[model samples]
Target: MSNPHKKEQHTGKDLPRWGMVIDLDRCVGCHTCEIACKMENDVPLGIWRSWVKEIEKGKYPNVVRSFRPTLCNHCENPACVKVCPVGAAWQREDGIVMVDPHLCVGCRYCMSACPYEVRYVHPQKGMIDKCDFCHTRVDAGLKPSCVEACPASARIFGNLNDPKSDVSKLVSTKSVTTLKPEMGTDPRVYYIGLDMATMEIKREAKLVWEK
Candidate 1:
């Protein structure tokens, strides 16, 4: 039932490159995003799809806590995809990194390869799972649950390929940084006003491989 008059659809480079931005200035370390993600994704009780990591600095009276929200970076050059022997770890044309549960054998090879240590084994499903930026909702013309649930509107999600997109504008204009940029993954997730102390504290023991 081919429609001879059907219009051509955009593909490859023309499609939207999904990305996210976390504005630390607006974030309150509330863990609301994590709870929203867990509820929306049906994640196992012992694990989380995302979380807000808090780190304290300075003396008691002058102490300050910084927050780093963690999730799948969905990199342009993903280490997981490279190390997945079965090709279970794959990326969309729009740059969303996803694991095909049907193809994944729970080998945990991708887990060892991921520098960010975001992927986790589903306790019941025995498959590696991580955030997919809520692609289903994106295709339905909606935002990711975590983004929509941010009480302070700290998270911004949009097509990075579009110059007019919020993510694109912010990344281009702000002093943003990504985790482990030196690793060459070229992560799409960006953070403004990120505290290196928090990043260091969070990655202290989770990294499986030496830099």
Candidate 2:
């Protein structure tokens, strides 16, 4: 009998889940990742699908700077999905949140519901737009454009369910925090090396705008 075991061999599934861990310390406040995401996604001008948010903290004499790259949190309990009058905005079982432009009525409800302000109504298309976490690229076994383009390797992507995965490992070893823990959205994106003062400023800004 020729190699029966070889013929019966099974191929394990490719990683299905996606999560990102951003190292705030390694980020140089360079907007390279943001630009890369825009270019890759072909997002329109005056409407960024991803962006870098800067926070300056301290008194007049001494100040500290911090940078945060913000995008759709892809929350486990996404408020956008709940508020959509139509079934346009939905989160996939694999954790990617997306919007169906064809079905969207452009009511902007989803935009208002997103606390992170990542969602925007497309100027021309009139449909709400936000980061899809590069679902197309993820399906192809490639990293998201931002993750691939980061020179500092500050953004790490992997399956959170897998304990051996890089994302899981980083979360285990580092001090990680999410954007709005109070909201209880259960955001999957984790940030490391974040300054508490900088986070407070961001929270204050979000509260004022209600975005």
Candidate 3:
């Protein structure tokens, strides 16, 4: 008997341009995505290319909880791109941020320039490292490890430019937000369930620590 629910293989132009939508409402702060990302990318200990940042607000009894999974913003106007002296980092035509590992001189300029603090200097690779948006699996027509491993289905990946795409539809229907909007990075990643209170907590923390 033929299976009616078999996963279809992507081919040619049917392959979607990549984007990620994180539903904060569904996220349990489990850190599964973080572990999945590290394992799939072989990211070493003490140097995470992706991570989860948790925010707790209010006085002890009235506290509210929020979890923000942070990764390279893959900004439309990536500061890392302009700061790289060796031109190792660049934004792709489809809006993905990437680095030429061979071209990187480990100067750490990109690390300093990124407002999101997602870039890291790899000790063994001897190069600047950050999320490549799971380009390997993406190119092979598979979802990113984090997206696949998410137990809550809190993450969605697709093309922002495609009107019919799930990400585009969700953004249109939901109140989505990005981190560090003041930096004018125009981050491609979007988050749902983020509120003013959550934003305020993050803002205050950054101002205190970044100083």
Q: What is the lDDT of residue 19 in candidate 2?
A: 83
**Candidate 1 Cα misplacement greater than 4 A, ranges:** 1-12, 201-211
Candidate 2, residue 81: the lDDT equals 83
Best of the two (1, 2) by lDDT = 1
Model 3, residue pairs in steric clash = none
Give the clash count for model 2: 0
TM-score of 3: 0.84
Report the lDDT tens digits of candidate 1 across residue range 1-211: 4322222333666789899999999999999999999988999897887888888899979989999999999998899988887777888777888888878889998889899999999989899999999889988999999999999999999998899999999999999999999999999999999988886644366665734
- Selected candidate, larger TM-score, 1 vs 3: 1
Q: Which candidate has the highest TM-score of all?
A: 1
What is the Å distance of residue 28 in model 3 from its true position?
0.5
Question: C-alpha displacement of 52 in model 1, angstroms?
Answer: 0.8
**Local lDDT at 75 for model 1:** 91
TM-score for all models, in order of appearance: 0.89, 0.85, 0.84
